[model samples]
Target: MSQSTHLPRTSLAALTLGAIGVVYGDIGTSPLYAFREALAQSAADGISRGEILGVLSLALWALILVVTLKYVLFLSRMDNNGEGGVLSLMALASRATGARWLLVLIFGATGAALFYGDAIITPALSVLSAVEGMRTIPGLEGMGEHTILITTTLVLVGLFALQPRGTASVAGLFGPVCLVWFAALAGLGLWHISRDPGVLAAFNPAWCLDFMESHGVTGLFVLGAVFLTVTGAEALIADMGHFGRQPIQLGWLVLVWPALTLNYLGQGALALHHLAVSEAHHQLMGNEDWFFLMAPDALRAPLVVLATLATIIASQAVITGAFSLSHQAIALGLLPRMTIRQTSAAQVGQIYMPAVNWGVLAGVIALVFGFRSSSSMAAAYGIAVTGTMVVTTCLSFIIAWKYWKWEPVWAALLIAPFLCLDLFFFGANILRVTEGGWVPLLVAAMVGTVIYTWLRGRRVSLERAREQGVAMADLAAALAVRPPVIVEGTAVFLTQDPEVAPSALLHNLKHNKALHRCSILLKVETVNTPWVDPAERVKLEVLDERFTRVRLRYGYMDKVDLPSDLARHPGPQGGGLLSAKGGTSFFVGRSAIRFARKPLLPRWMTVLYMFLHRNAADPTAYFAIPPNRVVELGSQIEL
Candidate 1:
């Protein structure tokens, strides 16, 4: 038998737009409340207006340095075969440093797990902030703050309920609407800024420095605010594969960033002019009459409707992010595979995981209900976002120096400032633990421990099975003596390693020694991007008179291609005998772990891994194999 190869073509434009619509939504929506919290902390400390403007300046610089410079300009280039995410970065790192791979893997997986926390918080706060504008609604006037909170929570719940349907269907409307939403935010803010041009001074870096110095330690406490500007910015790098490098870059540079900056500036201008507004009013109509205040009284009703739509898109982005983030986690072995539901057939980009959708929905609702307002949610929001950003910055440095092959000094020079900003935000957000920041950190810690345990336990179980299983020679000798019955036609064994002979080959020969006319070791390698080439479909090798090894390479971004297509895989040796038409794929399923462990991890962590693994997507489905063609040889080992 012989091997083959192929190439996948993709559109950079479509992917970039999709990235903007999906990836940037969480961070894009942050301007809604970032300034309010910053200003609130400033006021509490008796800081002058200059100090508030200074904080805004720091946030603006953070966005530029961390997001545009670090991610868009530098980190995006480190994509692993068109796959952009923490795991891909780790994979790239491993390729660069042959021996130190573990170091990168641990950091990447930890970063990915942290992202799950960000996913949950983004929606909770974005919706609460947007819906709080209902107080400005004429007929909705005097609506209790609690009432607004409950309504927002309910709305978020309903939005999540639509997850199984997939966002692709509705996203067409989302992108255009969000485009309008950002424009409206900028327009409204500018209208107010036009009313008073003093807000233009907020752009000066001096204000940010002076403000922090003036407030002393209190300035650090407000990091929870500075952290908001770039909360979802990681998504830009994480989902870079979706749109490729150009569109996301263009979207941020031309559309997303400008709109966001204008809005932020507008908000600052509004806050300065309306110095006497109560905290409640400020929360409702911050800095530039809150973007909603821009609409004429006659248009306020429609504007409320538009703001809700924008918030919905923002929430949708987080939900989609949870899907993408979980996928990366599962691939990295940080998470067990879940029932990943393909939401859109046309757009392979659109997907839904029921477990993640519901899990995140529950988390978001809990946060909203518990905090009752975006301000409190703000405290919880920054820590995870900034922490993840810091990780991203650190990883980006590795990516730049190794993968992108940039000079060490240059990479450090470029990344150091962003790292400092991220660290500053992380330090500032530390105060939020008592207020709200503890939520994401706690979530990240719990998730990271469970993932670590499951992966570790799984490694042990595989080794145990390998040791216990019978060898191939023994099975062949047994079959020669007494021929056993064949259960499935030409049983196909899928192995992680294509070069090495499969353990199943040895186990089967020893256990039943049943000789089939044909048997194959099917190895499928999922590559980085979504599509696969037909020419590279299957690589076949004949090992012995009865044994054969077939390696199938697939891009991670590619769909789970059907093995039936194997017949069409034309190689030098006629594509081998196991062409998918007549063979049954038998997969050995391994399950493991002990619930009680006193020496290493806490007992609670062991329990969590057991629970998470139990609910993971079953091996058969996850591999995209037909149920009837699969067999689970379940086994367990000590962790």
Candidate 2:
């Protein structure tokens, strides 16, 4: 359960409000273009009352089934130590199964990779759609497409530039601003609904079936567009650690869902009113910007400004989410370590990654220019999100059966409906691949390839190391019998396997022909949970008079501090090694990887793995070791 589950009522309310700002931002802003896009998909046969009601019904049911049921109610409860996300869920399932399952890893990687695709396209789509609302302004109806494009480009650039400085200063405003945004959505929706009560017939699911059966393939195209309504649904489960499940559920049920439903209904009602007016005048009705048009002409400008603010907030949420996900990937060894900067001293999760920020910024800019309009970009949107949803459903089934202790048959039955729904939506989106959906699929492919190569290369490298390495017990016994020239200080050797000799230690002894009077072989292991109890963090074993093996365990989300952890819990025997006359010296092995005579992997994969290894962050900086006190021993290794 989330820590917020035990909070006071006042704090609970605050968290609920926060969830509205961060968790629902993406879905909340869908009103800007979702209705217009869906209706456009089926408008080729001419605008009709039935089409509007059908699209609205599809959007409403999607929110209820996909977002409300699958994410908010079900998956939110399957968290790992109050943390939820693809990687966190992967860890939980792996621990429950008592091993690292390959299928689970692939599912986790696929979800995470698709998330990046969604991350890049969201800021571009949401901002462009919001800014494009200016066309609905009375005098701005003549606004050139170039003007809107330039303004959106500027807004996005400013948003990315502010990332390094951090959002802590302005984060307090996110909830309140979004609150006002949702209120506006409801107010506009209710006013329009009051004008045409006839559109209320959309509440019936019958219209969805009628439209699908009548339109055939065209209905599938509209179904893909309807998916925009639930594009940000993943945030509900992803942000569960930040705000407990209860608060998020309450926020969605009470405010976000109602507001979104009303907004879509309002858009439909407005379209119905236009259709009646056009028919009475003996003229044709065309698809319109019904969301902005719902507001009175006098208030249209302010509405656009508010919509823009809401979309920016949504974009900010996605950017930060990518950073958090990247951090988790590195901790789990799914990605190479990069420089991570904490934007806030009080919040460990408030981090900034320059590489991620710049890379996403570049992608967003390319998308905005390449598509040239939100309607065009919308073609590229749903595939990534739907793909992620499909992966999430599969992982949920494993968690239900293995981790929740449900019978396999029961689990299959429970998940089958949701899985089918996800696949149905995925099939709908697949129809748009040639219409720009290939963009995200290409991005996912590149990311998935990198993750696969890194994992395979690491496994092969570890196997090779173990083959050539001596056992720690043999080394300790040999050193005890033939003592080297004794040094005065203590030395710490870091390795992945504590049972084998660290390459750095052997190299140091071979070159210097001497050993530290007190030597510690240390290994750091990242566990499956989000936190480790301090008492259980360090385990010590004495191998001989001069050698002691130390193991430090950390959760995937925990911050690593080797020097501080060692100082807090010195080894046995009155801490003789740590309390040596000279301060401790840290030694790290630096491998120079190259292709083997008969490589385990293809040539291209070995090249990619070598590139990743060379560029990974330095161990001294990653582990928080003092730079001046660190020694790097280099060795050549074959893949």
Candidate 3:
């Protein structure tokens, strides 16, 4: 398949700002509150200015190391078509790794489920944090906290309401607004840095090293503390295909990274100045107001409004990502296909899976009511982010060594440091499972189990059906003696078991058994690649003189395009197989499987089969047939 260079060639400037807004929204907004939460967690005892600045510096490097260097710089290059998500990445691995793709499927589905949890938590916290500004509003002295919460909830509902209209309708403004958002963050930070230049010293690696050494395990605990700063980078890389790799990379390199660094430095400057000016101001809260302080008092209200808008944009990006991942999960066989309705024709990137949207809505509403504050929601956020990072790092090691064919020693050297850092985050986040982190972890486990079980049962069920199927030669010979009607065109039968008899064939013979003059068995095979040439398509098989079967091979990335211009292809030898004058009727048979145990995996999994029977995508949609003509042949199966 040819790689799609069809993305809009927006200026690097526009894409960067949008990338900052869309891809990095979660982490971009995190700097607003992460430092404060870190302080609350562990600011006592002996943590010094040098150690604090060092922690900030470590966060900067982690973003650079894990996100920019590992993923955007390299992994984004491994796109399956223009698709760049965990499931797409897993599909790419399947081509190179063979059966081992199952592990990748499991890992990717788990990551995707984790992302759903992240999506839910993000909107709850981002909106709540922005709305908390009501507490600081001048002359709003008597406003209740619940009043603010209620307003925030209403704002969030409004955001979700806009989803059905599709984001692309307003995405043009996303770039410009996001550009303004990052510029504001950077300009504010830089303006403060100019007032006190010594904060620049924290950029040096040694300060971070010194802090890590001095603080020991306490400093080590801060790894999770600082990890939040880089959480959205993976999402940035995952969504790169939507915005294009070059544009996204340019945005990060020119706009996001520098802007974020400046903001951190500005915050550090506030801390340093307070330490020197007042003894009581030497603690964590000393610079707590730096973000708010950046704006003039009169403009603070407007700045809060802008921050709220940016948070909404960020939440939209995550929600869309959840929709994309859910669709891919179905395509890859990890999950059964549901009703996948495309939300926008102009942008294939914009999709709406009702199942996921409602699921996320429920989770988000639950978190908002339960946690009630951004600080608590932060506890649940990292488990999904860190868990996904670990999964990606593990997959990268294999992808790098086997597919990229990096030198073993060189690949190990390249992958190990990041792996160790990810392990550290994973270890820290594991502690959080008892905390709010359990929300996503439990969700991921439940979703993953359902997906894996259904897929396994599907394979088992197909294998058993194949074993019981009668061969086409025998079936055709048995029916050859029947008189043929002088009917018009060929009837194409679509099925997976090629020569193996479809139960529908028997049912049709019994009921609608009026034999057509000619019939063709048409089987579609989804190949591993994206497209197949016509020369390899529609292979004709003559099963004796009477019966003919045609097979069409397609790549997974390719749509099952039934040829509308069939007039172009050469017809059968004497009279064409398709009679243009006489209309052709398409008949399809669907298997109706019962989950009654036939001694498959285990008894519990047999119960899972009951669920699968209820959940499987209707054969009508799966075959890509026009529903009006397709017939559902109900069959009772034991497995």
Candidate 4:
């Protein structure tokens, strides 16, 4: 179990508002297309009051059960040092079990990989759905498909282009804008509900059952689309550290949930009213943009603009989330190091990853152009999210059993229903694999493959290194006896294993034939937690008079700065070791990795690992080391 922090009442409101903006963005925009798509799935059988109410009921219950009960009430409480996410939860479970459980790792990896798929699809679908609202505008009724596509592409490109500059300036506006958007949703829903109070019958769970029983196989198709209503539910738990559980829960229960509930009801009422009119006129009613049509014609265009802004905000939240997740993945050794830039000096979470940003942008563009319409894109949306939800449920069960110390049977009973719900959704979505659902599935497969290869390759590489390495104790003893030509300054050799002599240190001795007056073997260890206490950050072990092995422990979410952390250590002679006027130099080993004669990994896997390693960011930048004071010792290694 994770500890929760109590915030001052004054700050709670602000955090709650921020939660409304970021946590609710994706789900907030779901009303734009969720109902319409779900209703469309059954439109082939002809629109009926029963079908409308049934679909609306499915959507409402999904939010209540999946978002409110599962995420807000349950999973939010299962945080890792106040940080909640797939990776954080994985770290927590791993620690609780006192070992890295293979099943838990697979669950975490699958959830994370599927999240990237959602990340790419969200921007394209959200923006496209909102832009398609142009069709309902007064003079823009004839807006061409190409115009919508181009406009969405331009908006997406601009959003990504602005990432490097940072969102801090406009982030303050996100909460207020989303606040207005939710209020608008409530207002629109209420207005249409007043037209037909009877539509509120969708609140009855019976409608969901009746719809399922009546529609049979076709209902599952609609069920897949209905899953979109809770697409961003994961964000509630994912962003818990940013705003805390109380604020997010308050935001959901008090404002976001009511607004969404009312809006979906209003959409149902509007659809019912339209069906009545079509029947009265002896005309067939087809699937329409019920979300925008809820507005009076005069207000339609402005509503469209508000919706576009909301979708953009939702997209921004997903993009930034991807950046943050990538950072965590790298810290946890699930992925190779990549360039991470702090977009805001004040907010540590406001980060930009160039590779992630551009790569997602490219995928988003491809999805937009390839799918061509939100209706088509909606077919692809739910599988990744449902897959992630299934993984989350599985992980939560482990946390419940092990960390919470619940009886295994009780834990299973408590979690089994949610797992079934998730799997049911997953199975429903599986029926759409041929119809654009394969997109996210294909993306997840590729990403999961990379993560698996990186992990396996790292293990093999470490084994290979161990076989060729000299023990640090042996090296230290030999160095003391030989006393190589001593240099004037301190030298820090960074390595993964401090017990083994660092390759750079060996090369420096072999080629330069000299050793620094003070040689520190520095190793950074990423612990299975979100933050480490400052007192426990640095561990110093004296290997010999001239050599010391320093281990810097960091939580997976902690920011790493080698120089600053080293300076925190008071040396044996007093004064900061990094503060020495004698000056300090950092030695990093650069490896040219190739397949060994008897490779531990498959030939193809070795090649992929090598490619990933070769393209990883420079160690100097990653470790926050001063490039001018850094020396790279190159070596050829076969693994």
TM-score of each: 0.87, 0.98, 0.89, 0.98
**Per-residue C-alpha lDDT of model 2 across residues 463-521, encoded as one tens digit per residue:** 88988899989998999899889988889999888888999999999999989988999
Query: In model 3, which residue pairs have backbone atoms overlapping below 3 Å?
Result: 16-251
RMSD of 4: 1.4
Clashes of each: 19, 0, 1, 0
The candidate, 1 or 2, that scores higher on TM-score is: 2
Lowest summed lDDT across 10 adjacent residues in model 4 is found at: 1-10
Best by lDDT: 4
**TM-score, model 2 to reference:** 0.98
Candidate 1, which segments miss by more than 4 Å at Cα?
1-20, 45-47, 276-296, 473-488, 495-513, 523-541, 565-576, 579-587, 590-610, 633-639
lDDT of 3 by residue, 1-639 (tens): 123345455555455566766777776776676665554455665435675578767767777787788777877776666556666666666666874666877677777777776778878877888777655557664778688778888888888877777887787776677788888889888887898898787778897788778767666556666777777767766776556677677777787888888887777677666666664654433334446656667778888888888788878888887777776666556777666555777765577766777778887888888888777777787888888877777777667777788887898898898888788877866666666879888877777778778777878877877887788778888778654344555566666676787766666677775655566677766544444666676677787554678777765444445543132344454544555445555666655556554576676776776666667666566555567756566666566
Candidate 4: tens digits of C-alpha lDDT, residues 1-639: 233457777888999999999999999999999999999999985798899999999999999999999998999999898999898888888888885589888988999999999999999999999999999999999999999999999999999999999999999999999999999999999998898999889989999999999988999999999999999999998998788889999999999999999999999999998999999998878899999999999999999999999999999999989998999999998999999998888888888899999999999999999999999999999999999999888889899999999999999999999999999999999999999999999999999999999999888877778789999999899888889999788999998888889899999999999999899999898888989988899999988778988989999888888899899879876787676567999999998888788778888898999999899999899889989999999876787
Where is the poorest 10-residue window by lDDT in model 3?
Answer: 562-571
